[model samples]
Target: MKKMIALSLLLMAGMMLFARGSKESGKTVVEIWHSNSGPSGTAFDEIVDDFNSTIGEEKGIVIEAIYQGLANDVLTKVKAAASADISSLPDIAQLDATACLDMRNADYLILPESADIEISEIHPAAIEALMSDKGLLGVPFNASSLLFYYNKTLFDSLSLNPPETLDDFAAIAPLLGEKDSTGKVTRYAFAGVPATYELGAFIGAQKGLSYIVDEKNGHMGTPSKVLFEEDGTFRNFLGHWKALYDTGFVNNITSGISTEFAAGRTATMLASSSSLTAVINTVGGRFEVGTAFVPMTDEEATGGVNIGGGAFFLFDSSDAVKTVIEYFVSQDVQMKWAEDTGYLAINTALYDNPEYLAFLDENPAFKVATEQMLQSNPAVTSIWLPSAYQIYYSFQSEIRAVTEDGKDIDEAVHDMATLIQRAIDEYRAQNID
Candidate 1:
């Protein structure tokens, strides 16, 4: 009986040792919630898988990426989680640029500096897009800027060049337009509803860089009022936009813009650089597609397009999270991400990579956005607002009133400014302390 008891004790000790070993050897699972879908989703998965097979395996870290839905959906879920329980938030999240304000306000965030992650290699414009008074709010992952797309085949046939300024667009519109027997425009020079996305560039493209809101477009602090009206940026943009509209070669077609452009019914359109792949694929070689920087308000304009798309925000300061973030920003990963999704590679080092240079040499169309971004003033950035959605919709509505309803430009601008100011006031009252 004494021997049996001794043997039993030995077995228990061995089992406990085995359990401890297993726990120590297990991989650290890092959960990430993201809004990337379609091609971007596939590319992201490949990146995760590559990391898991390589660095992750070596370091005993496993990255588990979960699709949370679209950008807005992810933002909603994140906010809800933060409100309910800060501990319940995912280790990391990929959210839209508009979430900058929300992330800045959330005290639960694990900033890159706190996590000891280095981000000096990222493009200045990209960093500026996510930066606020609090410092870097998030790391730019998939970023984009606006590009002016035109039918190269048509432009070449007429010996014309893509417009460099808004005035050029106005002058070129009549040349590219076609009219039916009744004087109704059959083919429009441009077809798009101007909104906040496009307006960012227009407002910024002024001497000394005009901002839509005070506080340097809400980067320094929470904005109390808009600057567009006082600065006359809106008025200046309207004068140019009104001229293009008065040419009667522009349309407010919101939907089917890509289709119309592809079908050769439209001459030019402004679209996000992220949509370049889709735009090209939609054309399907029916005509050569051309891309340029979104035309400036004038030749003297010093600003450029505002960075758009989503960024990665961390909630945990785990080494595993930092590793994953570093891996995503690596040169190979960023180059592949850009190639796969048509999003700009945020890594500035890619410009010097021989492979990337070769890729650009072979595919010149992909170079326009990068060139434009490099040339852009760092002051040009998105308007960070808590009521960004309402403000974006309001911009579209007010511009439509001017272009479609024949409302006076001055009245539309005033109404837009008033509505946006009200939104800011309401948001501050409800959310601010």
Candidate 2:
């Protein structure tokens, strides 16, 4: 009887030990909500899988992702979750730079230094976009900048190098196109939309004055005042662009600029570097596509292209969750992402990697995108304005009148100023000061 009791006690103790070990060794599951879809979605999943099998398995972490709708949809969902049940929020959520600004004050965000983030390894502009008074609001992800794509075939045939400034563009504009005897444009020198982003890039490239002024000690969420009208830079940009449009050198085809470039109907274009793969696929070996830095206003210009994209905002403050983010932003993973998706690598050192250098050598278009990124400035256009999208849409419409509808430059500028001021005033009045 004594022996049997001892045996039973030993067995119970053994089972307890086994259970505890199993519980301790089990992987911690980390959930990520993201808006990436289609090819981008697929590539992200592959990277996640790679992370799971390697770093994740070794560290006892399992990263899982759910495809929420778009970035805006995900933002809505996050707000809902934050208001209802804090426990319902995912460990990590992918949101846009703009939306992150709105949620800057949210208690859920895991700010920088929560983990070992190498701030110096990221582009300053990308870092700036996610920042608020509270510190770095999120981790930069899927970032991109404007790239100037030109046809190497055409450039070589004409013995013309890519333009380096507005003057070069002006000199080459009329020379690149074909006009009939009656001066009807049969081909175009450049193709772009009269949109806010396109116009903003031009303005920024010239080292023009700020479009929005940052008010120190103001409400962090609405910290900027619109200065587009008061600035001479905008007036000069409009006049120059309008003149080019008048000469039929700048084609205002709206949405078809990329198509025109792909079809070889236009000599040059400016597009998001994220579209590099699609552009290459569309070009389809017809001609060698060359990429160069978007021209500045002059040799002494000090400005950068705008940096825009989604970032990973942490809602659950867990060591495992932070691990997942660290892995995502690590140099190796970022380099892999750049290779697979043609999106700009978030790590600043990614451009210097030997593999990336080799890849860039083979893909000149991507190299151009990287070079352009080196000169990137913060996307200050509508970032702090309350009705940002509406303001931008209004600006786009007014600019189209100048470029496509023959509106006087001064008149169009005046109207844009009025529209933007009205929107800003309405926003300030409706919100708490």
Candidate 3:
């Protein structure tokens, strides 16, 4: 069933691509390099089509969006283009929020403020996450939050309610996992990547923990510092996770967690809100799927999730390109994008729109993310140095070594903090000069 859905989606996208390739003579073309694929990619292409027919026709502009690989790959391509030739870069690019600083530092992106780009229509947090030493770094697109997804059938079988607190989750997790007579694990309670996205959300779910320090706010322009070790949150969380791993309740595999969950070998997992479409497709008729606000700690029962996704950054400086961007962020366009792609709409007005409310009524699973966004905090990793993601992966490696290899947690945390501080120092040295 999953294969058939994937194949059909590909076929439809191929047909759409073929249909959109035809040029309308005399229209000025604006090229966009983006990392969106699958359903989001398809929805973006449709948005471009709608724009070309309506606003593009009126202004004699044609928007051409091309898939330029994933978020990180897009940065490499953009950097190469910057060092090579200006013409090689696309008019617009979608960059992961963490890497926005790199492009801004390289002068590869044009600040929307310079272009007098109006952003009053976008969500406040969305706009804030894109801000830098200059002006707005990018237009937030594909904004999303972390969500707790569970197999409803399994939960029902165990007479469990969806977890609301970390305590609840821990209590219920062991109940969901199973073993054979030989004590070999046959099922897992939780499984997911232990990177910044997951860990950041976990920390935010408990108050009084700052993941990263912003230089301008309190550090007086010092490079951002890792506060996890300082606050003891990282140590406590790691201990919890390590215990779960030792008990065989949680699997620490980097990949296949979602697949394992869908296959009934795992009960719950944390994932991006934008993954709703893909998850639904993968779990097609296998069992009912449920989504809830990510579990919070007891102190922060109303804890907020972190927003973690890429945004649209402009590299071109043309009125046509700016106009297309304006149109893209408009309420109508935002709603269409949200409905088609399952991303939270950046324009706040869309939330109260009758049409969007109706759509939410029909698709409650995706709405869980939207509701979470109302109380969401900007991911601390998003504000860290441009090398933040690289540091995060390294941190994840340390976690694996500690949890799976039985390394000392305190030693691992100290080493991980040192490694991250070094990366931040290097980034500041290079960019501040």
Candidate that scores best on TM-score: 1
| Per-residue C-alpha lDDT of model 2 across residues 60-86, encoded as one tens digit per residue | 998889999988789889989889999
Candidate 3 or 1, higher TM-score? 1
Write the residue-wise lDDT of candidate 3 on 1-433 in tens digits: 9999999999999998887778666788899888889888888889989998999989999988889899888888888888999779888888875666576666667878777788887887677666666667788877877788998888888788887766666777779899999988788888865786777667645563355544521113345676767877777777766756665688877788789988988888988888888787889979988888887645542447666687878877789988988898888988888877667888988878999889998988878888887766543334445466686688679888987788999998899788877877776777666
Candidate achieving higher lDDT, 1 or 3: 1
Per-model TM against the reference: 0.91, 0.83, 0.88
Q: What is the descending lDDT order?
A: 1, 3, 2
Estimate, for each residue in 1-433, the C-alpha lDDT of model 1 and write its tens digit.
9999999999999999998875546789888999877778888999999998999999999888999998888989999999999888999999877888888888888787888889999999899998888888888899999899999999999999999888999998999999999998989999988788898898887884889888888888878898888888888888888889788999888789999999999999999888788888889999999998898887767688888888899999988999999999889999999987779999999999999988878777788888888889887888888778877887888878887788887888899989888878887897767
Off by over 4 Å in 3: 1-24, 216-224, 301-303, 378-381
lDDT of model 2, residue 37: 74
lDDT of each: 0.88, 0.73, 0.76
The lowest-lDDT stretch of 10 consecutive residues in candidate 2 is 210-219
Regions more than 4 Å wrong, model 1: 1-25
